[model samples]
Target: MIIPFWSRLRLAPRIVLVIIGALLAMKAVDKAMPLVIRPPEAMFFDRDWLLATLQDIRDRSITAPAAERPALLRDLPVRQWLDITLLSSPPDFRHSEREGGFTDLHRRITDRLGLTPQDVLLKADEPDDPEYSPRPLVIILPPLPTVIMDVFDDRSANMLSSDLRIAFRIGPQEDWLVVTPKSDGQEIVRMTRNVALPLLAVVLIGLLSVWVARGIVKPLDDLAEAAEKLGRDREPRLVGSFNAPELQAIGNSFNAMQLRLKRFVDDRLQMIAAISHDLRTPLTRLRLFAEYLPDPDQRRQVMSDIAEMEAMMSATLTFASTQLKDEPRSPSDLAAMLISLCDTAADAGCMVAYEGPDHARLVYRPVAMRRAFANLIDNGCKFGSHVWVRLRETPDAFVITVSDDGPGIPPDQFENAFRPFVRLESSRNRDTGGTGLGLTIAQDIILTHDGDIMLSAAPDTNGLVVTVTLPRQG
Candidate 1:
């Protein structure tokens, strides 16, 4: 199925979009929550109690001694959510260019106190400034600023535009008095809820970002693993599904390249195999012609040359066919296979012995692996008088060492030993019945199975030690 454009958005874009969407969703929920659970009329502004308190303060300022008036308002206990404070003078007000809608409320407050409208000041809720709100509201309050006190309600005092806020001078000689409701526990809860909503939204967005990051990284991880397998010359299976369009395109291109490389290699091997097979016919005819030579010495030389040509042609065909063949891997007993090969060599009168675990199971192409090991054991027996085949298992892989007591090849010639038809006389010889392809074919088979082979001098003896290491399967 075709993936949607939204599903294939890049990592950065996807995370940004999800955060924006979450913020919008939170805003929608915030707007709809109040409608779902509406508060009753009882929770609104208590106008009666507010006006009565204002009148009581005004009456006290008129009757109390001038010096004691400030104390009288300050000493008034906060009761029924009403908080009263006395100030030296009125606070600064936001001077409106045009008369605002609070003129009726101003007149009402003055009438309640039996005073003129000039003695009373009423302010509707104003837009909150982060630096000005939350604080005492005194720092930014102008030399004659209006007092702002926190009042308890379902919403913040700063958010309620219709709240009744009043500031007025108590008496002509007394200080100004500010009266407003103090916040209760419910107000704190309301404020906390407002704050927590945005934080909750942020946490949810972070989790969404993490999920998108994993989705993006998982495909790249798959691509890297497939590339590693390809480098080891093995067919690797890659996950086909991808979350991003760019990753999908990259995967397709990589698979196409692997297919092309495989086809090209197969074609070359097939051509080599065909050539080797065809050359055998000519070599056989030469053998027949050599048998009828007049001079005995010439006949022997010709026969030797023809036999060597046949051996080379057979080895070449075998190498090409091995490379061209595709084999499925299965679990096989490696120890048993090595023991069997050693027994066969011993029966053929060679000094060969096997030493290792009785059973070592590993996943591999058994036919190809068996041939590679056989060639290694045969080469060892031909070059050395005594051959020892040992198997050892490590945490990650199994190691097999074939040690032979023979003149070892120089360290510098080790790398060239695996080349096709290249023989080092110090360690290998034509008389040894090797077409110089034994190590070449073995190395090819080992690499196909993601294994490695190395040559080193035997530690305790004058011989060459061939070490083959194959990785363990999960």
Candidate 2:
């Protein structure tokens, strides 16, 4: 059955549990390894050599001359794998004691060699470096897998047991003999357990962290991308089945917000369209009535007033339609479209010129984008004698600029110009016949395509420069 463990866990608790589980698993492996693996007994010392050497020493103590006993013991063949040292006095025995496995080993060696208890001494310890120090008769492997083991010194490695040493005498006054194994295989086993395994566990933990982080970060990245699409008027909904409960809740909320926001925008646009459409019928009747008025001046004045009102209403309806329309985007040649606009304006007796490449492909709503650029070009021609439409390409975006040498807007009024029905009277006068919806409509269209539009003063003249930057869609 599916348990859905990750779905129920929050992010913080999940990360903590992952780390703790890894540590516990390493600990279990560390404890179980010693029972499963052990160094070869022959690697320490040959059992046959040990038994023969002890028997030779026992025979030498009785039959050998007292003066030649040291020389005979020194020539023993066991020196190849074991160190046999002869000291003028007995070695330090203040801390040496026979216990556990060492006590049994001492008793067996004494019985085999026919030696008294006072003639032999044995002590076993857990050694840090068995090659350099005396190790226990029965080896105890390193325990615990932790990062702290990396800094272990000799003292720390030997902390588990006491000092291990064995000494013997042929007679009460004879020089003492000390035996130590010379093989380093036991040290290799200890280092492999104490140092190598922990390092391996560290690498495993790092990989585990990367795996966990990717699992958590993927859903967040999807959420961020969805938010970006929503801002660009692309309705996007997030999935509810994120790995964690907290992220799933956020996804559900984001999906709900997208639905509500789309409904709100659609309702407001519909209301505006209905109001604009209803007002036009009454204005049409008024226009018909004004034509039959007795006074000519009053009649002309009434007709002009009615005409301006009709123009305003028409602009309002267009604005509403532009917002409510959901146009499908496709790849189109933006440069060709700009050139056509320039040609049309030139044919109408406006000094218009187009500059840039012959073809530039971009993904956008064709009709909406054409209307946006058309407004910019027309506004430039209306205010200035000459208008320049230039398109440029960058690595990541396409930039279009429309500049006119007319009276430019003041820096402070730049933001206010984009507001609906806002006409900067100082720069753009009433004679221009603009309802002030051109820039506003153009901004909405460009923004809906995930593009930017900004207004600035012309560099070399008193004119307005409109710059539009659109991101490259992949």
Candidate 3:
């Protein structure tokens, strides 16, 4: 059964996306719901109380002075605000434009102050007092400009202050409650929803984005680890393709890359072998022609040079022919190969020995392995008094070390040994000679077989120790 592409997403980031999706859904609901409803109103005294207050003030006009007014007005809660309006009544008829819609109060004050029609009138709210009560209208005239008292908690009074309309009203002791038209409840709800809805949506989106990031990142990390193991020449560890299309493609491409590289190495080795055959023919002709030289020492020298040239060419060509094509037939016992190479070096009049384990194995080209070891042992014989070959094999790899008791190489020239055709001499004469390609060919062979070569000062033994580590076949 095939899984859908989205199913391949990992847990953590998917959770994040789900949370973001939820917030967006909430915001959508919030916006859609409120577009359907309307806006609440505030209320005060009933019609009976309003008309009665107006009638009482008309009948009981007080002859009381300002100081006596507060005491007498306090007898009725509604009466307290009447004294306030009486003090402010003169100016309320003045400054007519500031009166808002209270034209009734404006007319009353105009009569009391005996102001002509051209006199200005103003109206303003009463200052809040603990002892005073609410009175909803005021009118001002020019004579009363220095003081103001009465407009109240009524909404119409608020609207007048905000200059929405002209206020009109007609007396003191009258409870005419005014209302300012507004949809404040609806405005506040919309503001709250506008802020909350988007925040919820962003939270949901954040969750979803985190989920996607993790899903994409996880497969790539696995693919990278697999590639590294393949590059280090470890076992071919197979990773299953992901449900995601891009990740599957990446896995397929890496598998194809490995196949092409192996085939390329095989084809290249075949080409090198063909080139070696062409090189050998001319060298053979020169060896035959050297026999006709007249002087005895010169003839002997020519033969020696020809013999050395043949050996060097044969070694170099053998290296090129097999380095890439030699598929590892089986893991060979590494301990046995090193012991055998040391014995051969000893027979050639070099003091050589082996250290480390008796049985350690590695996957390699058998012929190439023997050749690389022979070159290293031969180099040891040329440069050192005594040679020791050591082995350190782990579950992952086997390292072969060759150390000697000869004079150490110069600190600067260690890497020079690995270059082809570049030779550093401890001996001045041109007598010690081979194709300067021996160490170079050995390194190439080890590298092709997924091994590494290193040269360092030998521990307490006074010369260089060359190490080669080949991966152990599992």
The number of the candidate with the highest TM-score is 2
Best by lDDT: 2
Best first by TM-score, ranked: 2, 1, 3
For each candidate, what is the lDDT? 0.72, 0.75, 0.59
Pitting candidate 2 against candidate 3, the one with the higher TM-score is 2
RMSD in angstroms, all models? 11.2, 10.8, 15.8
Q: Model 1, 1-474: lDDT tens per residue?
A: 897888668766887887788788877877774575332122234344455767887888778987887677677764455567677777466422224324444555678888776677665554253221221221111123233453322122122432334678876654677665553334444445557767877777777777777878888888887887765564545558687777778888888887777778778878988988888888888888888999999999888888777878877887877443377888999999999999999999999989999999998888888888998998888889999999999999999999998888889999999988898876477666668999998888888777899999999887899999999962
Task: Report the lDDT tens digits of candidate 2 across residue range 1-474.
Answer: 685877688989989988998898788876676675553332323333455666665576447776776787678776565566666687776434534444555666678777787777776565454333323332322244334443234333312232435577755676677766544456566545667677868987888898789878887888888887776654665555688888888888888988888788778878987998899889999999998999999999999888888877877887878443388889999999999999999999999989999999999888889888988998999899899999999999999999999988999999999988888877586777778988988888888878899999999999999999998973
Regions of model 3 farther than 4 Å from truth = 1-275, 323-325, 361-363, 393-396, 411-416, 425-431
| Candidate 2 Cα misplacement greater than 4 A, ranges | 1-3, 28-203, 211-216, 234-239, 290-307, 322-325, 409-417, 423-433
Model 1 residue 208 lDDT?
75
| Model 1 bad stretches (over 4 Å) | 1-3, 7-12, 15-146, 149-210, 228-243, 293-301, 322-331, 394-397, 406-433, 450-452, 455-457, 461-463, 471-474
TM-score of 3: 0.47
How many steric overlaps are in each model, in order? Answer: 5, 0, 49
Q: Tell me the tens digit of each residue's lDDT in model 3 across 19-107.
A: 66676677576557545532122223232343355435423434455455445544645643233233333333334343443454445
Worst 10 residues of 2 by lDDT: 151-160
